[model samples]
Each structure stands twice: as C-alpha cells, then as structure tokens.
Target: MTDDARELADDVQELAEAQRQHWQNTYTTHPGMYGEKPSSPAVHAALVFRAAGAKDVLELGAGHGRDSLYFAREGFTAQATDFRPVGLKQLRRAAQEQGVAARLSTVVHDVRDPLSLPDASVDAAFAHMLLCMALSTKDVQALAAEVRRVLRPGGTLVYTVRHTGDAHYGAGTAHGDDIYEHGGFAVHFFPRHLVDSLADGWTLNQVHAFEEGDLPRRLWGVTQSLPQ
Candidate 1:
C-alpha cells in the first residue's frame, strides 16, 4: 500500500474503535436501534440470497442482525458475527422478534481475528462497511484472508462501503484522520480502490452504486466470487 493508503487505513482503525463505542451507547439505550431496517447492502444481500438459492450465509459485521433475520426468514441458515456484545444481544432479540431467532446464530467474533470456521464451510459471506473498519493494511489483509479461508470454493462475497471521491468528505480537500464526532466518535471515509483491494483473489463479479433519494450518498456495493 502507498503512504496515503496506509495513513487512511490507520484512520479507519481509530474510526472503528469510535464506531464501536457509538453503537454500544446506541443499543444500550435502545435495544431495537438499527434492528428494524436493513441498509442498502443488507437489502441487496437479501435479494441476492433469494435469487441465488443460498442455503447458508454469514454476516461478518451484523450490527443488529437485520440482514441475518432477513436471510433466516427466507429459509437460509444465517450466522451473524460482530465483536460487540451489546449489539449482538440486541441482534439476537431482534431476530427472535422477527421469528428467525431459532435459525440465526449470533457469534461474538472480531473480523480481524482468526475466523473460527472449517475450510469452505459457508455458501456465502457478506460484510457491509467492514473492510474500512480496519486500522491498518495488515488488519484488512487478515480480515480478507479469513473471508477467503472460510468460504467454500465458488462461494459469493458481497459487501458495501463509502466512496472517498464522494462529496461527503467535502470537495477539493484531502481526507485525513482528524476525528469529527458523529454519534459520539470519529468516522473515516475510504477510497474506492483501497476498499476493492481487500479481496485478494476473489473475482469481481459486479460493482453497483446507489443512493436513497439523494441525501448526499456515497456507497458502493461489490459482488465477488471466491476462488474455488
């Protein structure tokens, strides 16, 4: 990675720590926070699961199990993993309310850590806004390698992240690690190419961009096929 990319990745790690604190606060006060609605990536993953005949799905950064519930409702065995206990507790409750709790497994696993799964165990894995959460290139690479290691040959990997070129970071200004409090902690926006490089050997299947009625959106979705 270039110096700029390395610097950005460091910012992302701090941002992740901040984000964890923010969510911990959010779910502590409101168990149902972020439990009802799925983001664009979650919705997109749901559609893909439905269309692709997915039987087993893994959600890496399942915030509140929204997508996991969606997958379980659609007849797929879904496992939701996140490092936050509070969030995962809410996610478990949310899944119960959605009537998929029995089928959904909530695991308190950090993505940067070694994935505790057998080789080629799952049919698909999806991580929404996960790649950008790493603090450095090594973290990202480890997460990517885990993603690759646990996925079955020909399994699908789908995810989404914020685009750096978007105006959210302000136009004509360089992006830096200076923190700004949003929901209590600082956040980092990632460039597109850096995000794409997270998937070491996966074949890029599709890249799509979408927005919700023009609310200064900057998200891109990527679909890739894991190496067999």
Candidate 2:
C-alpha cells in the first residue's frame, strides 16, 4: 500500500480500538443502558422476518439484546453479537431471566472483521444503527458482504441507519468518510447513495423513515432480500 493508504488504515484501526474501549466502559458504567424495551425497528424487523418464514435471526451490534430477547420470545432462535463482552453478559442474564436462554445466544464480535458464522447459516439478519457506527465506507460495504455470506438464499435483512438528514450529521469531529465523533461516540452518517450501493445484488424492499430517542434521531429502516 502507498504511504497515505497505510496511514489511513492505521488511523482507522486506532479509532476502532478507541471506540471499542469507550463502549466497554460505557456498558460497564451504565449496564442495560438502553433499557429492556425493543426498538421500533426491531419490532418491525420481527414481523418482516416472520413474513419471510425465517426461523432463525442474526442480530448485529446487539448490545444488551433487547431485540434479541424479543425475537426469542416471538419464537425465533436468535444469535446476538456485540463488540463489548459486558453488554453480551447483560444480554445473557436478561435472556435467562426472561426464560428464553435456550432460544438466544450471544457472541462478542466486531463488525470490522469477517463474521464467525458459516455460509448460508442464518435465515435472517438485523442490524439497527450498526452500519452507521464509526465504520468507513469500505468497512460498511465489507460488513454488508459478510451479512450476505451468512444469510441463506432468499434470506431477509432489516437494518436501520441514521442518515445525512439527521440533526447530528455534520456536527462533530470529522474523521472523513462521513464519520464524525461527538461526545466520544463516533458515527458514520449514511448518505442516500451509500444505501443504494449497499442494496446492489439484493432485492431492495423498503426504505422507511423514522425517528427515535429523546434527540429524536432521524433514520431509515431498510429491508432487502437475497434472490432465491
């Protein structure tokens, strides 16, 4: 690689490590910070998964697993992954408490790396606000490919991302590639074209706009399916 390319790769690695530490500390301090209720996108994804006849669900960035537990409760075997082990521990505790331990599993995973799952293993995948993390455009695209690799043919993917129209889109420490860090949290606000690019080779189903949280973050709930 060229010198500049090497520097950028190093920077991305440093940033990813920093963010992982930040998340670990955050979950350690806050514990179940997002509460037990599933996000609106997750609820919608469950319905879509059921309609697609998906018996198993893979959830990325499933911190504390609110949605994972919900899916287990709804009768789908759920595999939840997050970079933070603390968060996954909390998710495990919650799953046991909710009597869905057998139906739910947790893995500590970083989305930047390839998924540990086997090819065509999962029936559905869901990722709420994960693709919009501190990932570069390349990293996000790689993650999309990994999701596709794990999902069965005709498998569905429902994901949510904070878009360029959000209030915080450009209001932070710019890391280039549309990524910005604010209050020690980095986000890669998605542009419309990025969304369209990610959907290439897949059947784009819907792009529904929605808002959430006290800041009322604006996001798009995207659904797509692989060709059978």
Candidate 3:
C-alpha cells in the first residue's frame, strides 16, 4: 500500500477500536441504554422473513441480542454476533431468561472482518443501525461482500443506517466523509447515493426513510435480495 493508503488503513482501525470501546463502555455503564424491546426494523424484518419461509438468520452487531431474541421467539434460529463480549454475555442471559436460549447462539465477531460462517448458509441476514458506524465506503463494500457470501441464493438482507439528515449528522467534531466524533463516539452518516452504491449488484427491494430516537436519529431502512 502507498504511504497515504497505509495511513488511511491505520486510521480506520484506530477509529474502529475507539468505536468498539465506546460501545463496550456504554453497555457496561448503562445496561439498558437501548432497552429490551425489539427495534422497529427487526420486527418488520422478522415478519418479512417469516412470510418468505426463512428459518435461519445471521445478525450483525447484535447489541444485547434484543432483535436476536425476538427472532428466536418467532421460531427462527439466530446467530447473533457483536464485537463486544459484554454485549454477547448480556444477550446470553437475556436469551435464557426469555426461554429462547436453545434458539439463540451468540458470537463475538467484528463486522469489519469476513464472516466465518460457510457460504450460502443463512436464509437471511439482519443488521440494525450497523451501517452507520464509522466505517468507510470501502469497508462497507467489503462488509456487503461478506454478507452476500454467507447468504443462501435469493436470501434476504435487511439493515438500517443513519441518514445525513439526522440531528447528529454534523454535530460535535467532524471527521471527513460525513463522519463525526460525537459524544465520545464516531458515526458515519449516509447519503442516498451511498445506499444505492452499497446495494449495487443486488436486488434492492425497499428504500424508506424514518426518524427515531430522542435526537430522533434520521435513518434509511433498506431490504435487499441476493440473486438466485
């Protein structure tokens, strides 16, 4: 890699570590920051997956496994992964308490790395607000490739991301490319074109924008299908 390229790679890694640490500390400090209820996107995706006869699900950034537990209770076996072990532990406890332990499996996997699961395995893959992390455009493409690799032919993938219109989009300190270091964390806000680029080579099904959270974070909800 050229000197500039190497420096950019190192910066991405540093930012990722900072993000991981921020989330780990947030979960540890406020165990219920996001609460136990299933998110809107997850609920909708679960219904859509069930309608399509999808039985196996792979969830990325499965924070506290809130959505994973929902999938389990809905009769889908879920592989929930997160980079933070603390979040995974909380998920395990939640699963047992919720009586869905047998249906849920937790793993400590970072989204930046290629998925270890075999190709064409999961019937569907789901992620909630994972796309808005401090990931560069190139990293998003890599992550999409991994998601496609693990999904079965014609498998569905549903994800959510904060849009550039979000209240916090330009708040705090800016990092180039619409990313900003905010509240001791990094958020990479997405524009409409980025979403289109990411969904390239796939069958983009739905594109909807909605506002949620106290800052009422603006987000784009997307659903895509891998070609058979």
TM-score for each predicted model, relative to the true structure: 0.81, 0.97, 0.95
Residue-pair clashes, model 2:
0
| Best-fitting candidate, scored by lDDT | 2
Instruction: Tell me the deviation in Å of residue 51 in model 3.
Output: 1.8
Candidate numbers, best TM-score first, in rank order: 2, 3, 1
Q: What stretches of model 2 exceed 4 Å from their correct place? A: 1-3
Q: Candidate 3: minimum summed lDDT over ten consecutive residues — where?
A: 4-13
Candidate 1 TM-score to native = 0.81
Query: Candidates 1 and 3: which is better by TM-score?
Result: 3
What's the CA error at residue 6 for candidate 2, in Å?
3.5
CA lDDT of each candidate?
Answer: 0.72, 0.93, 0.89
Error of 3 at 19 (Å): 1.4
lDDT: which is higher, 1 or 3?
3
lDDT of 2 by residue, 38-140 (tens): 9889899999999999999999999888999999999999999999999999999999899999999999899999999999999999999999988888899
Model 1, 1-228: lDDT tens digits are 999877776766656676677767777888766547666687787777666656899998887677777778878899999888987887787777778877899889877679889988988888876665533556666777788888888888898765655455533332354223332434345566665686557788888886543656566788888765
- Candidates sorted on lDDT, descending: 2, 3, 1
TM-score of 2: 0.97
Where does model 1 exceed 4 Å of error? 1-15, 170-185, 212-214
**Cα-based RMSD of the predictions, in order?**
3.7, 1.1, 1.3
